[model samples]
Target: MSVQRRKYDPDFKRNAVRLTEDPDRSVQEVATNLGISKDLLYKWRRELRLKEGLAFPGHGKEALTEQEKRIKELEKKLKDAEMERDILKKAVAIFSKAPK
Candidate 1:
């Protein structure tokens, strides 16, 4: 039997990270109260700090920074251009063929 992992939403993660921000509350204390491991809380805090607005994009979704987003857009454009070029090449080849 496999133990299923629990999933927490972005809001819950943000709230947990926020609670650790309190001056009076220790990370261990907060984690204990929340029934989570301190390491997990620390990891969340690190992601929140590093990713900021892009953190916690949830399951099956990517969290891309501004630079990453731009790169993804450019890559998509390149793929489309390459596909069009291939199609045009095939068309030209077919049209250039002499009738039997």
Candidate 2:
């Protein structure tokens, strides 16, 4: 039989995270009392850290700013210019090799 995963209350998670900060009780003890696992406690701590102003990867919102749009446009133009240069070089070679 598959065991059902239990849901923990937000307050319980808060207390569990707080208990981790206490020198007296270890994370495992707090988690056991809260009817959860040490790993879950650690996960909760990570979530708490984010709420406490931690910057986790890919967590920040990105709305393409004006400067960023301009930079992207410029990069595309540069690529187009390179392609044009290559095409011109090929055309020059083809014309130069043709007989009059």
Best by the lDDT measure: 1
Candidate 2's C-alpha runs over 4 A off are 53-100
Estimate the overall C-alpha local distance difference test score of candidate 1: 0.95
Per-residue alpha-carbon lDDT of candidate 1 for residues 13-52, written as tens digits (9 for 90 to 100):
9999999999999999999999899999999999999989
Question: How many clashes show up in model 1?
Answer: 0
Instruction: Please give the TM-score that candidate 2 achieves against the real structure.
Output: 0.47
* lDDT of every predicted structure (CA atoms): 0.95, 0.77
Model 2 deviation from native, Cα RMSD in Å: 7.6
* Top candidate (TM-score): 1
lDDT measured at residue 76 in model 1 versus the true structure, 0 to 100 = 100
In candidate 2, where is summed lDDT lowest over 10 consecutive residues?
53-62
Q: 1-100 in candidate 2: lDDT tens per residue? A: 9998666556766777989999998999988887778998898798778655332223244335578779989999999999999999999999899596
* TM-score, one value per model: 0.70, 0.47
Q: Which stretches of candidate 1 lie over 4 Å from their true place?
A: 76-100
